[model samples]
Target: MVRVAERLDAVAAGLAEQEGPEAHAALADRTIEALRALRDEAGAADWTAAAVPAVRAHAVGALMQVCPLTRYAFARPRGYPGDAGLLDLIYRHPDADGALAEASAAGRAAYAVTSGTAPCAAVRERRRILAGAIDRAAAERPGAAVLAVACGHLREAEISAGLRDGRVGRLLATDQDRESLARVADRADAPAVATRRLSVRDFIAAKATAEAEIGRFDLVYAAGLYDYLDDRIAARLTRKLFGLLRPGGRLLVGNFLTGLREEAYMDAVMDWQLIYRTQAQIRAFAAEISEVDLAGANYWADSAACVGYLELEHA
Candidate 1:
C-alpha cells in the first residue's frame, strides 16, 4: 500500500507542476505509462505485494475530482463496472459532448489522451462491426431474428439499418439493469426492439424458458459480457447461445485482447477490471462446443487491435 501510495503521490506531484492542456496531456500520457509498468510488474509477481483494490480506490477518488469520464465510470449507476454510460463516454456519443464541455482543466487533459487511445477507438469500431453483423444477418435471412445478450444500452442497434427498417423480424435484448433496458425501450425505434429485464445468470439458468419464450435467432451476439465471465461460464454460455441459433445462424462473442494501452488507467483510475483473452484462448472457448458442427469459426480484432472477436456459425 505504501509503495502504491508513493506512486500515486508522484503522479499527483507531477500533474500539480503542469499547467495548460498540453502540459497536462503530456503528464497524463507519461503518468499512464508509468502506471502501466507498475501494474505489469505487480501482476508478474502474482499481485502479492500489490494492494490493487486500495490503490485503485485511492486513484479513482483523486482522478474523479479531475477527470469527468473516470468519475462517471467510478460512479457506476448500474452498480457495476463497464456500464453502457461509461462506453458512451468513451465512444463520445453525441450526448457525451455536453459532459466533455463541463470537464475541469485536468479532466479535459485526461480526456484528450485517454479518449484517443487505441482501446477507446476500438470500442467505437466494435459497435460499428456489431451493426454490420446485424445487417448481414438480416440480409441473408429476410426478417431475421436477433438477440443481444447482456446488451448494454444496445447502442449498436442505432447504427443497424435492418433494425431501423423493420427488416429484423425482432431484436430481442436482455439485460439485468432495467435502466439500460428503459433506454432501449425509449428509443424512437422501440417498436422494432423488444427488451427483457433479466441478469445473465438468470438467462443462463433458465435456458429452457428463454428458448421457449424468445424463440431461435438468426444472429445471436454478446458484447461487454464475456470479459467479466470465467472460462467455465463463458463456455456454458457459448453452448447455450449456440443452441438458440437457427440453422445457419451466427454467434459472435467479444473479449479484450492481451494488450490494452489504457488498461492501467482503467484499473487504477476507473477501478474497472476485465479478463482479457488471447486468440488461442478465445478459440478454446469455441472448442468446448463439441456437439455442434460449426460451419465456420474465425477470430478477428478491431482496427485498433484492442478487442478480439470469436465468430461461430451453425450449419
Candidate 2:
C-alpha cells in the first residue's frame, strides 16, 4: 500500500479518480519507513515502483493522524513529470490566484525559509515571487529582510547572487543538516552571505520563539515545508510563526505545483512523495490564526516545477 501508485496508472486508466486517501492508510510504521527509503531512491532498479514515506512516518509520530512526508518531497523536485503535473493544478486555481494579488497589493514582501539552493525551475519561480513580495514591502520599509535556512558552507553564496542586490536585505541562510552545512565552506563564493544552521525540527520548541519574534518581523516565508506536515501540525507551526510576527507580520507557505491535486496516497515521495494541501486547507488553517492570502504560483524556468506561494497575516 505504501506504493499506491505502483500500479496506479494501470488502475487509473479506466477510472476518473483511482486514488484515495485510504489505500495505504493502514501501513505499519516500519513498513512505511522502508517504503519511504525506497521512494526516495526511485529504485534505479525500478522506475515503475513508487513509495510514500511521509504517510508512514506520520503513522508513527502522530498516530497516522498527522503524517508528514520527508522534507524533500513537500515541494516537488524538478525533472519528475509526476510532480510537475500536480504543481500545475495548484498554481492555476482561480481562488488561489486572487488571494495572491490581494497580498501583493497590501505591500508585503516574502522572506524565504529553506534548507539550501534551489536547483529546480519551479523553486526559481517561487523565489522570484518571494523577491517580488519583499520588493513590494521594501518600497515602504526601505530595507526588507529575507531570511533563509541553508548549509554553513553554502550560506554566504546563497546571499551574494541570490539576495545581495540593493533591493533585497539580509540574506540570512542556515542549515540544520551538519554534513550539508560543512560543504558550505568548500564552495568558492559561499562565504559572501550571512548563514547559520537551523532546522524545522529544531523549531519544534517554537512556543518560546513567539515571545521574541512577534511584532518584530514583517513576514515569515517558508517555501517547501507545508506538504510535509499534517494540517494539525501545520496549524501549530502556523500559530507559532504567527506569534513571532509583529501585529501585521505575514507568513508565506510554498507548495509545489504539478497540476494535480495530490490529495491521497501522497507518501510516494517519502513515506510519501508530496503531501498535498488545497487552497481551502491553507485558508482554513490561516483563518484559525488570522486572515490568509492564498495564491497559485508560476513556474521557475531553472527548476521546472510549478509552485504556489501563500501569504497569511495577523490582522
Candidate 3:
C-alpha cells in the first residue's frame, strides 16, 4: 500500500505541475490507468476504504482535481456531498454545460469517465422515473400536489411532462441549500414549482408543523437524500414522508445499491460516500411504516442495477 501510495503521489505531482489542458489531459489519462490497475490488484478487500488512507497520505487531492465531479465534491462548495451542482454533472443537465466548457481537458476527461459510469447512468434513469411518477400521479389525482424533498436544482422538472403542461397544480420543491432553491425558482416553469429552503433535520423535527405548512401531497419523493441517511434516520424519514401523503398518495425513495461498480472510485477519488442499500434493505423502510397502508409498497433496481428504489402507496 505504501509503494502504491508513493507511485500515486508521484503521478499526482506531475499532474499538478502540468499547465495546459492538453498536458493535464495526458497526465489524467495516465493517472486514471494507474488507479484502475491498483484497484484491480487490491482484490476485493474493500478497496474504497483501503484506498482512503493512501489518498490522504499521498496528498493526491491535486490529481483528483482533474475530474470536475471529484473536484467539486472534494472542494465542497456547499460544504457537503451530493450538492445540486454535482448532480447536474451526473445527470448531464444543461446547467452543468458551462462548468464543463470551462473545465480543463483533464477535468473533462475525468468527467467523461465519471459521468459515464454505471451509477451515474442509473441516476439519470432515476430522474426520469421520478419525473414519470409525477406525471402519473397528476393524471390520477386532479390538480395533484407534489413535494420533492431535498430537491437539488430540481432538474427532473425539465423532463417532466406534468410540469411542462401545467398539469401539476403545485409542486413544492425544498432543499437545504438556498442557492439550489434559487436556481429552481429561476427555471422557466417556476410558476408551477414552489421553492422552499428546508432541511430534512428541520422537517423531521417539526413534523406536525411541516405537514400543516406543506399540506397533503398526492406524490412525495426523495431521490438522492437517502444515500446520506442511516437505516434509522431513513426509516424515520420514510415514515414521516409517508404521513404527509394524502390518501392514495405515493412515496418513492432512491438509493445507490451496494456493490456499485464505481463505489471505490467515488469514495477514494471523488471523496463521495453513500450508505448503499440492497433491495431488501430498501423494502425494510416501507415495512417499518406500520401505521401506513403499505400494501402497494415495492422495491426494485434500476436497469443498470446500480440504484435501488422503494415505493409506497397510501391506501
Candidate 4:
C-alpha cells in the first residue's frame, strides 16, 4: 500500500509539472494504469472497505488537488455521487464550463484527461444509444409515447431527431431532482417533453396507480438507475417498467459492467460506487417477468465495453 501511494504521489507530481494536452494525456494514462494495477494487486477482498481509505489517505488526497473532476466527484456537491452536475462535466456540457473555469490550469488539464476516459466514453455512447432508441421507436410507431425514468437533464432528447421533428408523441422525463427536471423542462423541445419529479421509491410504491395515471408507453428506459439498485429491487423495477410498455413496446435499461479499469479510482478517490453487473446478471433482472408476457430480450455492450444494456420487447 505504501509503495502504491508513493507511485501515485509520483504520478501526481509528474502531472503537476507537465503542460499541454499530450503531457496531460500521457500522465492520465499512467494514472489509470497505476490504479488498475493497484486494484488487481488488492484483489477483491473487501478492497473498498479496507484498501480504499488507505489509498485515499496516503496519495489520492493530493492527486485530487490536480484533478478537479475527481475533486468534484469526491466533493459530491449535490450530496450524492454521479449527480447530473458531475455528469455534465463528464459530458463536456456548457453548463459545466463554470466549474471547469474555477479550476487551476493543471486542474483543467487533468479534467480534460479524466473526462476523456473510456468509462466516460461509454457514458457518452449511452446517451447516443438512448437517442437512437427513441428515434427508432418513433420511426416504428409514429407519435410514440416514451418514458425516461431518472432522466438527468434528458440530454439525449437534445439530439433525438424524433423529438426534434415532432415525431415523438410525448416524452415523460422523470427524476428525483427538481433541478435536473427543470433543466429538462427548459429545453427547446419542452412542448413535446414533460417533466415529473419522481423517485424510484415513489415510482415503485405507486406502480399500480402509476400505470393508470401515466398511461402505457411505447418505450421506457432508465439509463443510469440500475447502477445503484440491488438485484431484488432491480428485478422488481424491471417487472414494473415492463408492465408499463404497450403491446409491442420496448424497455431498455443500462448498467455499468464489472471489471472496469477505473473502478478502483472511482471507488477510492472519487467516492463513487456502483453495482456493476455481468451480462448474465443484467439478464437475470427480468427473471420475475412471465415468459408469456415477453416477446424477446437482448443484451449489448457499449463501444468501450464498460456499459451493458438490456432491451426487452413486450408482447
Cα lDDT computed for each candidate against the true fold? 0.80, 0.42, 0.80, 0.85
Q: Tens digits of per-residue lDDT for model 1 on 1-315? A: 236667766766776676677666775676677677767767745443464555665653365446667788767777899888888898888867888888877788878787788877888888999999999998899899899998888999999988877788888898988888898888737466899887767766875875788789999999789999988888888888887888889999999998876687777666788998898888877766764468889898887778889999988
lDDT of 1 at 142: 81
Candidate 3: regions farther than 4 A off? 1-3, 6-50, 56-61, 188-190, 207-209
TM-score of each: 0.90, 0.48, 0.86, 0.93
Give the local distance difference test score of model 1: 0.80
Q: How would you encode candidate 4's per-residue C-alpha lDDT over 1-315 as one tens digit per residue? A: 335667777776776766665565566567777877877877776465566777778654565556778888888887877889888888888888998888777677777778888999888888899999999999999999999999998889988999888899999999998988888877646477998898888767775776799889999999889999999999988998899999999999999999988888788778889999999999998999999999999999988899999999999
Off by over 4 Å in 2: 1-121, 149-162, 167-169, 179-193, 207-215, 257-272, 290-306
Which candidate number has the best TM-score?
Answer: 4
TM-score pick, better of 1 and 3: 1
Candidate 1 deviation (Cα RMSD): 2.5
Per-residue alpha-carbon lDDT of model 2 for 1-315, expressed as tens digits?
235344333332433342333322322223333443544455433433323333333333222222222222343343332232232222332322443354321111110111111323454466456656555545645555545432223322332333444544444455565544444434434232344566665554755654454224554666656655677777776666555555555566666543332222233333234555555565554544633433222222224334555566555
Best candidate per lDDT, number?
Answer: 4
RMSD of each: 2.5, 15.5, 3.6, 2.1
- Weakest ten-residue segment in model 1 by summed lDDT: 44-53
* Candidate 3 vs candidate 4, TM-score winner: 4
TM-score of candidate 2 relative to the true fold:
0.48
